[model samples]
Target: MAALAATDSADLEKLLLEVCSSPSWAADVAASRPWSDRGALLAANAAAMARLTTADLADAMAGHARIGSPKAGDATSEREQAGIQGVDRALLDELHGANAAYEAKFGHVFLICATGRTAATMLAALRERFPNDPATEAEIVRGELRKINDIRLGRLLDEPS
Candidate 1:
């Protein structure tokens, strides 16, 4: 969307603010050099996410819940639909339980690369990763966030309307 590139800095700022609630992070993303491709744009966004402190990461997580496969009627919900797929109801229930337990243990939401993964697979991953120490989990969470950004940037850079 080169037209988006042509947008003024203030408009760009507003757009990013809509995408991410963190003011400092949004400002940094808006001030970044114009990207020629989706990959570059996503890389920059991921780098910014990686730089956030643990508390900041928690705030970002609060902005996003699990990517729901069948999106509800809301912007943020639709955004989450990108990474969701239908799965067995039982598996979904188990995943929800696991997610709650994981959050209680880690003091942060469970994060995973959800693109193309089924609920069962994601649940298995969550269970497997539950044993990692906080430092290790933080790195994993950053990687998952980068993957999500990559998906979002691809959508953003699609051919203009």
Candidate 2:
């Protein structure tokens, strides 16, 4: 909250986009600057995301890194998927295969919060979700994107000086 309040508008927009790569969401939040606190910021984010068009959601989803593939995304994503780091080669292979299967079915990267989940857990979830139809999967994707945005937003404010 303090950090956002102190940041310039352009930088805030960039930061918001980094958290959730939806231009509409980032612009709306940037326009509502000087948030009273983190709660208000979060509420704004949730509302903006709720109102997101399919394109916006797709834009946000496109920003995510695949689970167990840290090299595929930014520093934030690398950190977010830290739990998958240092896992055994077999688990990494499984996660890669699962990611490929998920992408084949969904036509996009499998995105989750991945803040504190292991490769095995993520793989299990990916497999568990394979049977879901597109509509169901989209809803799940929306929920996961929201979680990822929330975690990223918290981290933006939590960064050390």
Using TM-score, give the best candidate's number.
2
Number of the top-ranking candidate, with lDDT as the measure: 2
lDDT of 1 by residue, 67-150 (tens): 333336655445454434555677677877888888888887787766666666778888999999999999888777766666
Residue runs of model 2 more than 4 Å from their true location after superposition:
none
Query: Where is the poorest 10-residue window by lDDT in model 2?
Result: 69-78
RMSD, each candidate, Å?
A: 2.7, 1.8
Per residue, candidate 2 scores C-alpha lDDT tens digits across 1-161 of 67678888888888888888889889987877678988888887787878888888889887777788776547877888998978999989989998898899988888877888888888889899989998898888888888888787888888884
Error of 1 at 11 (Å): 2.7
**Model 1, residue 19: displacement in angstroms?**
3.8
Q: How close is candidate 2 to the true structure, as a TM-score?
A: 0.91
Clashing pairs in 1: none
**Clash statistics: count for each candidate:** 0, 0
Residue 112 lDDT in model 2?
A: 77
The alpha-carbon root-mean-square deviation between model 2 and the true structure, to one decimal in Å, is 1.8
